[model samples]
Target: MSMEKISIIVSKGSLEGIYPALIMANGARAEGIEANLFFTFFGLDAVSTKRSGHVKIGAVGNPGLHLATFIGALPGVSGLMTRYMARKMDRLDIPPIPEFIEMISDTGAGLYACKAACDLFGLTKDDLVPQVKDIITVGEFYEIAEGGQIVYT
Candidate 1:
């Protein structure tokens, strides 16, 4: 069946965590579906003007640390892994996080921030990425997401 819209909930702040949502949202728009991104909890990082493009992968608690947990505990393994990921992304022509957000916005996707998360994180609208069209509660998001598929990542 064809969908008219899709709502993607992004709840993770880490680089690895955010990508899945971004990919899905972009994919939805690619197929002419309206897309909305709801940033809740730590997911605000991906839409924070100060944090968006600079999200880091957490090596410590990450289940897929890519190295033996013991080896991943080394002082600089996270940085190494981050660099390795950057290289891989670059080779694949993935834009930086900030640019990715811009592209999604330009493609007519709506970006929404979670009000509770903003309050919990002590952030104001100005602290959010420019692409954010509104700060909304989950209830409001639900209203907007009506008749759309909701994918939580």
Candidate 2:
């Protein structure tokens, strides 16, 4: 049987954005689907060992945090709060970020960093996680996502 593909675009640098992509892609792969993650702009940090684990959850002065803690929490606000808590766990050396990224990649998910973004950031292929498949253009990413469901996170 031909496996269905799920393409995920990650555009944020925060732990909130990165984990969802990893979780979803890993989940898709667990179900035997072909999973691909495209990292662009700040999202490239998700696939970069140097930056992936360093993401800070914005708690202080964050509009979302203020809204969640005050004026009653939104429907999905708890999840955001959970993500913020997880960042603190990292400080305790629990479930390191690299381990999480490895867990996702080990499931056969294809990871790609945006070539344009890499150039803009002065990052080379060597700067990314060793598991990354390639540095590709947005066009190349779209070509991969053509027949699949594409999700932006």
Candidate 3:
């Protein structure tokens, strides 16, 4: 059977963490497949108006960076990596997080925030970006994501 839908769960707050889901969802939309992005836990930072623009890369403890934990943990290292990656993405014409989310939303893809996560973080509906359709529970997400492939990142 052909894949008709996708449900991507973003759980991390970093740049690396959020971009994969954005790319996947945008790709799915481009392919005419139904797509939904569910932002939960720390991932909410990617959709938060206050934090989306400021989300940083997680260099510490990230094996992909190939850096020692201590070095990655140093002040300014994460910020440096984040800026470096942002510049690279810019060179490739990739939009930043806010604009990316807007583009994804314009594609008719669904964007949602986890209600439990919002409650845990003391966030209200007004605190998130306008692209978020709603703040929903896991069960609600399941209901919306039913019959779709589930990808967690």
- State which candidate has the highest lDDT: 3
lDDT per residue as tens, model 2, 12-106? 88766777787788889888899999999999887786887677554434575655454334454555665667868778654655787787788
The runs of at least 3 residues in candidate 1 whose Cα sits more than 4 Å from the true structure, single-residue gaps closed, are: none
Better of 1 and 2 by TM-score: 1
The lDDT, on a scale of 0 to 1, for candidate 1 is: 0.89
Give the TM-score (vs. native) of candidate 3: 0.98
Tens digits of per-residue lDDT for model 3, 1-153: 889999999999999999999999999999999999999999999999999999999999999889999999999999999999999999998899999999999999999999999999999989999999999999999999999899999
Q: Each model's TM-score, in the order given?
A: 0.94, 0.78, 0.98
- The whole-model lDDT of each prediction reads 0.89, 0.80, 0.96
lDDT by residue (1-153, candidate 1, tens digit) is: 889999999999888888888888899999999999999999999999988877877777578765567777779877788888889999998877899999999999999999999999999899998999999998999999999999999
Candidates arranged by lDDT, highest first:
3, 1, 2
Off by over 4 Å in 2: 1-3, 60-64, 67-84, 87-95
